[model samples]
Target chain A: MIGGKGISIWFFIGSLLLLYGIIITIANVVEMVSPSVDKQPVLHELNFGVWWGILLLIIGSVYFFSFRPWKKK
Target chain B: MLGNLKPLLTPLMASSSSLLSLGWVDSLIIIIYFAFVLGIGYYLLRFTKTGEDFFMAGRDMTMWIAGLSFVAANLGSLELMGWAASAYQYGILATHWYWIGAIPAMLFLGIIMMPFYYISKTHSVPGYLKLRFGEGASMLSATSFGFMTVFMSGINMYSMAIVMKVVLGWDIHFSIWVSSITVLVYVVLGGLLSAIFNEVLQFMLIWLGALMIPIIGLIETGGWSGMVARIQQNFPGGDYTHLWRTMGSFQDNPMGIHWTGIVFGLGAIISFAYWTTDFLVVQRVLTAKDLRSAKMAPIIGAGFKMMVPFIVILPGLLGLAVVMPKLVPENMVSAANPHSYNEVLPLMLARYAGPGLLGLGVTALIAGFMSGMAGNVSAFATVWTYDIYRPIHVKLTKKEESDSYYVKIGRWCTVLGVLVSIGTAYMVQQFASIMDYVQALFSFFLAPLFGTVILGMLWKRATKAGGFWGLFAGMFSSVGMWAWVKLDPSALKIIALSEYAKDMAENMYRGLWCFLIVVIVTVVVSLFTEPKPEKELVGLVRGCTELPSEGHLPIWRRPIFWASIVLTVFIVLNILFW
Candidate 1:
């Protein structure tokens, strides 16, 4: 039942990859900004919380506008 | 020739009393556990009515059972024992793994990934690949999964053998044979049903073992506060302090592990790939009675994961702080050395635990080992029978084949899987730590496959060519990066990097970078390629619309949508402050 054209599949795969890359980049950049002092122990090395939050926000917004759960044929 | 025989014979000679010293009670407990496992296998034989029954337990598993089994399957003896040992050497940084790496990743999978996966209703994770991409991607993913299974089997066997050698004084060869035979017998007799039921029992024993050690340690050293103070006195620099404080160093500082490595390097990728994509975990979910149960299983498993560090890792810290000082430095050194960290948990048990309780600890240890082994065997058999065999050789009306025929093949596959695993286990013995070896091998295959699979599922524009090429590119890049780090640690150094950053860059698995490259290349290629048909993409992404409505959400929004937002904030705040 589930099938797709070659180009759409490529786009989908590319976007997901890009999203992961962006998330990792953001996490790395945040780590650079909040560099830990030599004397104090580093509490958070990578801020996955922040990036994961952003991801949820994006996913949520897309779902909110596009979703039509109760729509009938 | 005589000298060669003596080297082997010496270990055998030493094993007798070591086995005997296990005490009659301990021996009886082990025997009983073995019998219980075999009994489950035999009892479940009747249910092996069809291939589906054997491979998936006829998809009748309840949420709680599936969830608990998921936890049990993942909590191999090596995991607990290795974690405890890490705590002994490094400190509380070990626990940070759960907070940063496991919990969030699991939650992500449960809410985001599972809905997509469940909608597809494929039997194996790779089967979804065939649907989304093509036969090439599916075949590649399945092959990688097979390789991983073989790798894991070897590591599990090797670790179990090490535990026996250290705790029970069995020789390496004897231990290997015993562990292999024990797993092989039951797996060959039953199938997933036996594996799951036995996992329930093993989970209980492992929990008992994990809980008992710390309780006994606390009792032995007086009480909670008394034990803490003693640990403080023994290990300076407050290494015995709270868990979060320990992420600074990799060496003697128990808590000073590089937090990035704990969360991102190992945690995010490994947990996400394994829980969301790997057959070992997915098989458990697929057997769930319905979608609700499948969704609930990983969530429950995550909750259980939060409790693990306290039970397993803390005691190892206690052992290092309070118990090991009594041991000679040479003995402790020999035991705690990186190459020998596997001995940490066993030595702690042998030295500290009292006689009657010692038997229970040993039983629990074996339970953990066997649970992992059985999970792997069953999963491998499922993949072989369902994904490979059924697709290639056996194509009939689903109802035509007698249930017994499917069941018979399931049992045969179990034997074949175990035999292959045993051979791999022997090879894995060359590695220093079983965990490291398994993780390293997994990263190579997992990251690239993950890139392609995520692309195919979520992105409508992704081409099969992109998916295929992206996977290869990711794999090659990851492997190349890994080789560079290993062969020349200083080659890829970036200026002004934090000590933790430097460590991550230096020791980071190349496979992760490979994954990144694959993703990048795949995206670039897809951008230039022609788009796929919308009709084909619809069901692949949006899922079946005709099914009876229960808890279905539109592809875009659900309550978990908001919850993920709020929880992410909470996790961040907690990490920052703590």
Candidate 2:
């Protein structure tokens, strides 16, 4: 049991954010991988999708890993 | 008008669109969703053995569950559908409700107010007022809150029905009754616990259900910049993309609300009152097992809340840029009906999502209404039982009843609450601008309630007489102002700079004046009226109470730290959109 009040929840939320970022970044990569999508006029603007993902990832990772799940306080 | 995305409309933009086009798969998805909601309620019934279990979820809710439910209860048909419509009509400016209007105040509540609330062990917001200002204030807040909750529930019901009627061509009465009865069952059976649980579930579904619009719309438009370029090309000088630019002057903005009204009237007073004091959301936090969880709930909720505009508000902007222009002619005239934009959310759902996804999308809409209605009904029941009914019962009978007796009454109140909400939903059909009226209710109920509670909590000298009279004065002033504006447009013109300052029609300015009346009256009356003894006020008053130390937690995990991050994001978003 994580003893801290908000520790575990932060980890969970952070991980979710990181996961969201990874997924979107991965999707963009996949679309970019496709020659057809790349050739299309769309700039594949990852503006909000990528940036928000990165922000969430940072916030989520910092919290998620703040306390080692395996360590005892 | 969604220029580049026009091709994405394809089959969806076909002349005929209805629920039948959603197919059997969609219907099954919706059916399974409802069954799951009701099934959980019935399943949770045995756990609800006591009034505590029913009303406060036995006060054992964790930070995540409580936090998610806190945000979820705030979202509903109104947030999803109404704001989507507002986004359609008002543009990116509508995002104010999600960002500036919400984030700062929610952080304030989490950092400042939650300690007092959690420590008090109060069953409801009115119960808190009762401790500080005495029972008269309690009863007034309770009765007004009780009415507000039911009416709010009805508005949710009405909103969903209208969306369905416009989109799927369903019978409004059928939709309203269906949602009302479902909410009545789940809430009555499992009470607050069920409501909270469903709220969390509804929260996830809403995201899964609605995220497609911005996703598909963004992709089709080649991304945010592309969409912006298209919108600029299509609606040049329309004030659609810029957030603060239009707020320079009332006439500059499409919505016509100036920066002062948005900031002071809405961002401070209205937002703080709703996020901090409204029991419907506050009750969720109070149910947390401990103070830490309670404080964490709203902060976590603020995180989620900051993201909501991307889902709800963008659809509205997309509607204006894409769907509305496609659905109507370029020369189409504006009407008073917000539902015209309200349909934008549903259109986005229909346009992008299909088959199983469509079912999920539609279910998301239903979930929003049911979750919203259940939230209101459950809140009404708690306030009615603890604040209104129980006190009256004890006074009349000169006795305290069994926990079971009160529980029974709560259950009965739940039923009555649902019925009243359903009735209110029927009444809502008469109004053209439903969301405006719903927002107006805050001026009438919350402005005064907030006045009393904020004064009572912060200032120990706020006497019972002051609290009661302040509440009365605040509500009276608000209603009188509303009436004055309605009966005599000249009065509104006199108050505002221009006939078209757009401030006159806004509930924000009205709430501001009402809030000012509440504050002035509350302070004046508090000065004159005799205050209660200091001994009587302990934990209820700030500085008199000992707040728990959270120093052990690191800065990253601290509420203030997260609050700063959220505030930073808020500033960045405003600047980016400006």
Candidate 3:
């Protein structure tokens, strides 16, 4: 009973969610694998900064583009 | 006798200057904000002419207002205060709530679930269930949802009141009265329109306040790197190094991410159920002009959800590093108690943020609290008027009289809902973790409803008997799990229990076991029961399609579906290992 347009939209959204989930999951894996010293991990901020920037970019683009509501008419 | 007397005398002995001398600036800001909210509510009263107008804003809400209110309602003062408190106490694992749970659930709810819901053309989530499943399922869902709405609203009020009391050293009753009166007046006067307009203003303030802290804090700390270094210097460990690392045992390490099972398993399930099935959120989407706008609401909200860790969680982590070190050991003891997590952000704002920014921060907290209250009040009014009252008052069938009566009743319901929530807030001091308490309370109702709605939509075999039984099973199992956890602490050890699991069990209500048990029982029981009439299933599915000729999945979207599956698998593996 799902429509072609509805399916297409769901597919696009599902992909984006999955991609974002993977990126976050990978970031967690890198955090787990990275070596730790007695008290601190070297280059923690630099590492976090890189991933944080990437996430912000992706999320920001999505926010800007979402304003165009897809009308059924 | 002396030990007992100290508890009674503590309030009288405490300094009153901090409460009374909240300077002209803070007093002025609060007064202006209060007046503006009341003014808007009174102005919007003109629009509440009919039931639709009062309950759903005449179903003419645009994407921007609906989207903004949806996010604002979900991000209450408790969220910011709770996040800061958790980050202050537990390491960064709290951020997973945003990254792993809320974002995905929001998107799925918007894109997948909302279209189906909008097509159903029902006013509330439970109303949709009544159409899809049967009356019994709808009533059960409504009762459960009602309990959750009132209890969580109470928690939200309590958290906001406590934050204000902590910041200004005001009396707890004073904080409660101010929040309750302001929220009750607007919701009573304007219904949903007033709620929405005020929510728009509240949303802006919350964003302004939440963002202001990190900006001002970063400047004071010399920038992001300096702030990072400051935190590192204070709370030394690998736990603080990355956002993903756990803090070992939960008991010894108060900040440890011990509820991984709950987070990934039950947390994911119930969050999806909530965003997809709960009426407070679904009501906003249902009010959308079209299916596309309805879908856009949550997707837009998800984008904002991604920013929460930065605005709410990170600042809290930084606040603890910056402010807690300066406090006396006795003050630290009172601040770090598990029950007092809601006080962390407000304490940080009062201690560190400069004067001009402090007004804005406090305004944001109030706005967040009010928006959540407004959403619940509006939704409660809608359900009571449309589902409960109108059905019972069948003698008045004339269109004009019916519409007039419904609107009047909706307003009354709004007032009653607000009053009850305020009363409920008085009891919030009893709960340990506000977040877990709200979530567990919600799961009791949400899981069963989710089972019924999803099955009713996808499977024609789901009958009223099965739907009702599944609902009972789901609610019972979930509540049983929570009650068992409360009564028998040792029982949790059977589930490959981590040491942190034991700690979280003592403090927080675990609902994952209940959610899974409900879903399973709902499905299994539905299979054994008779199929619903084909006409019922067909009618529910009709709204989900575009046109008679166009198919469900166009050929063009096939590759995207495959790619998504691969990506989901990849994420699953990463989370499992990481």
Candidate 4:
């Protein structure tokens, strides 16, 4: 009953992805913040790390929020 | 912010990794990824108590997990590297495999084939064949599929090792064992659910790692049009940039696959055989909680499948446009060259992905390889335990076995299957490019298997004998075709109308012929043989069963509706990229 028997697999998947994305976005933001004047990291432009994080967060949010834990009916 | 960032080009370029290097940050990222994947398997193992839980995730998967896992299983390292390599060598013509070759069949599976498969409640594809065609066909399909799965796993293993060795200078044995051992530990401990869960994670990583290359490359080249201009400038008279223009004739294109062959051979036969019947992918969908989710799985996969070419194929085109100039002199000679085409994705990774990002990209490659290995191993285990072992055990013992006993057998099968795959991996270490060998095997096994399955599901009169013999004849024909080319040099040329017919071994054409022969043989044999009784055929054949209605979801939410949208995208891509 760690995540509980009733929790959908998507909830776990979404939670993991959401957490991973947050970590990546935070790391990138920190990295981007320290860029030298007139010189920027390529990571800022492509933002795949952040974008993937965002996409995973959205997907995870959908799965997590959709779960009706108390709606036995 | 990325616009002003000039891609730091590595001055040295070779297929060998001795010239390239990795730093501490990259290593740390890799270690963390490994720990996380292993942790997932260890945690999931606690929940996987029975055969169903292990193999089918206790039938609790939602549409998204099932769909993502289904597509992820197909997005193996071989697929990532091989298709990218194909694009490097064959140019845009390789897009056919992703578009027409994949979409129509995926949609067909979602809309048409899903009902029969899901309703039957079969654990594996071979189990489906057992119900439809009886023991002879099931064993044949199972044995062949079991063998093919391992061999294909080996091909993935070999390609992964080759890519790493060529690009990073990793020891071949180290690369092989690193992937195989990692996959084996998790798969054996946690079974199919572990594999599926990891597959979804790997899918995310694959997209994240591969997306940067195309985006950065397109930016540098001034978008698709700019990339097209660069390709033309790099190699003129090469219709490498045009998708359909070079497809008019075999001689007109770089791939030498004529429009006719591209459509009939690859689009219809090879694609259908793969997307429709390959248990490596279909088993993922089969793990869904219900028939509705099962049907929805491939529709969602198709939508994602359409976008995959952008991730895999664009890197190859970019390799040609940019990386080729940096490598040797002025030329596009990769296909037959020693491990040249296989270097495309890695080369792009070197250029665009630096430092911490490089670790993620490399790990993505590793993830792809392990997921593919795990998929094959899991599928092989299911077939061996359910289709091959159980019947023999029952016949010998004259008693029914416990569910837990069978689950134990499945775990052992995973171990045995992985061991055999390791052997095959080392067996074909000599072959540089595995794309052809793998395709030929698919034609031999899947074309005939697909022929039997299609007929059994669609035509009620398809007898068990017809199913078995037709599958055998079709397989026999493909092997015969392979041997014919080995003996007679002009055999493929005689069958092919286009002048530039010798580019590939033409696995596509072989698959087409195998499909036709199976259909004819099955039909002819079914007519002479006795058909199954109408009562027994319920839910197994098309007309025999009433189709289920989709729940009252909105228009956009329906699987069929989404399938149509994916198809529309497919058509639009063909027109735009043509």
Best by TM-score: 4
The parts of candidate 3 lying over 4 Å away from their true place are: A1-73, B1-21, B247-263, B324-342, B392-401, B427-440, B502-510, B542-578
For TM-score, candidate 2 versus 3, the one ahead is 2
Chain B TM-scores per candidate, in order, are: 0.84, 0.92, 0.83, 0.93
Q: After superposing candidate 4 on the true structure, give the runs of residues whose Cα lies further than 4 Å from its correct spot.
A: A1-73, B1-20, B324-339, B430-439, B497-499, B503-505, B551-553
In candidate 2 chain B, what residue range of length 10 has the lowest lDDT sum? Answer: B8-17
- TM for every model, in the order presented, reads 0.75, 0.84, 0.76, 0.88
* lDDT for each residue of candidate 2 in B1-578, tens digit (9 for 90 to 100): 33553443332221244522444445555656677778768866877878898898888888888999999998886678778877766779888888888998899888888888888889999999888878988888888889877877777677777667666666678788777888898888989988987888788768867887888788777777887787777677776777888787777777877898888877888888889989999999998878888888899999999999988988777666565344332245355322345467777776665334556677778888788888888899999999999889899999999898888999999999988877777777776576576657655787567767788788888888888888888888888877787789888765554577675335777777777888888889889878888878878888678787879998877777877888898899889998
Q: What would the per-residue lDDT of candidate 4 be over residues B471-561, giving only the tens digit for each residue?
A: 9999998888887876876787755554357635267788888899999999999999999998888888999988877777778777888
- Superposed Cα deviation of residue B467, candidate 4 (Å): 1.0
Query: Chain A TM-score per candidate?
Result: 0.37, 0.56, 0.37, 0.62
Q: Please state the error at residue A19 of candidate 4 in Å.
A: 6.9
Q: What is the TM-score of chain A in candidate 4?
A: 0.62
**Can you write out model 1's per-residue Cα lDDT over B32-119, one digit (the tens) per residue?**
5566667656655655566666777667776667777888888888888778876766566566656655677666666656666676
Candidate number with greatest lDDT: 4
- State in Å the error of residue B100, model 2: 1.1
Candidates ranked by DockQ, best first? 4, 2, 3, 1
Evaluated at residue B339, the lDDT of candidate 4 is: 39
Q: Which residue segments of model 1 deviate by more than 4 Å?
A: A1-73, B1-20, B219-226, B238-240, B246-258, B261-263, B326-341, B389-409, B428-439, B492-512, B542-577
